[model samples]
Target: MGKEILDLAEWKSTLTAFAKERDWEKFHTPKNLATALSVEASELLELFQWLTAEESTLLPQKNKDEKLRKNIEREMADVLVYLLRLATVLEVDLSKALQEKMAENAKKYPADKVKGLSKKYDQY
Candidate 1:
């Protein structure tokens, strides 16, 4: 059997229910959610600290044991959850925002001009 798929609305509803159940919605203001999202992102980054680039890329390999991989997954989920919560509280449409940002980035970093380059848009 395949895993269940959840759309953004479903995720938002689930998160809302979770917060409501715990009386946590009052604490989930946009500012608080953004701060929590940043903290969670930092926690995720800490997992990769001091690792060589290749080691960081290989962290989820089965042979490496599940503990580190699980920690990474948990931290990533925390970051995503807080981000979603923040977006919901702020009434931001994340899908549309991401698509618009991707379009803007494409214009800023055109493949023909910026291929294989790591410079910022203005520097390229």
Candidate 2:
């Protein structure tokens, strides 16, 4: 098991320290971070590229492959780390942004009207 991070601030601080230690902070511009984020997200998505729906859902589960699960976990962590770094660089409050977006989503896709529906909010 790995050490637990208590909150976003801790994760940011830890990642910042890591970058600083490696003298990599200079390359962590918003654009670069966003690009890295996209690449990492793509890598994560690639992990399930050929699996059927059930196989995708059961990733590293049906087969009980620790290496597969670890690969997925590492790719996911890379994506998140870059996202957090980008948010930090842009001075964005992710928590507040998520709250606002969720509120907008609830209004746009009210459960009473869109229950069990898969259409886009604008479509319905």
Candidate 3:
């Protein structure tokens, strides 16, 4: 079957259905999902644990090892899945939340002030 283009709602519904089918919803509370999200994020970070800054930046293209690339991809997907699950459980409107967050960040880190700086917003 052809893959359907999935929006946030559809992705949330898919994850919800998968949880329901496996009777996993009982364990999918916001707190649990949040913890899972953090764990998955750590797993993703682990993929680059020993790499230098430049190596990490070049990982996606410079690494010719298909298996390593696949591992990175899978870890990234795990992080994203747990994040989406957490957001869904919290009843967050992801798109709206992202827009609001971007607006806040834009104010905090105005281009003129932060163009080449990697410092925190408070430092700007």
Q: How far is candidate 1 from the true structure (C-alpha RMSD, Å)?
A: 2.0
The weakest ten consecutive residues by lDDT in model 3 span 57-66
Which of candidates 1 and 3 reaches a greater lDDT? 1
Candidate order by lDDT, decreasing, is 1, 2, 3
**lDDT score, candidate 2, position 20:** 93
Worst 10 residues of 2 by lDDT: 56-65
Model 1 residue 64 CA deviation (Å) reads 1.9
| C-alpha lDDT of candidate 2 relative to the true structure | 0.89
Worst 10 residues of 1 by lDDT: 4-13
Q: Report the number of backbone clashes for model 1.
A: 0
| TM-score of every model versus the real structure | 0.91, 0.90, 0.90
> Per-residue alpha-carbon lDDT of model 2 for 63-112, expressed as tens digits?
57677788899999999999899988898888899899999999999999
lDDT of 3 by residue, 16-111 (tens): 899999999999998899888888889888888988898777767854667778988998888878878888888898899999999999999999
Question: Judged by lDDT, which candidate is best?
Answer: 1
Over 1-88, each residue of candidate 1 has an lDDT whose tens digit, in order, gives: 9997748777988998999999999999888998999999999999889899999888767869588889989999999899889878
Steric clash pairs (candidate 1): none
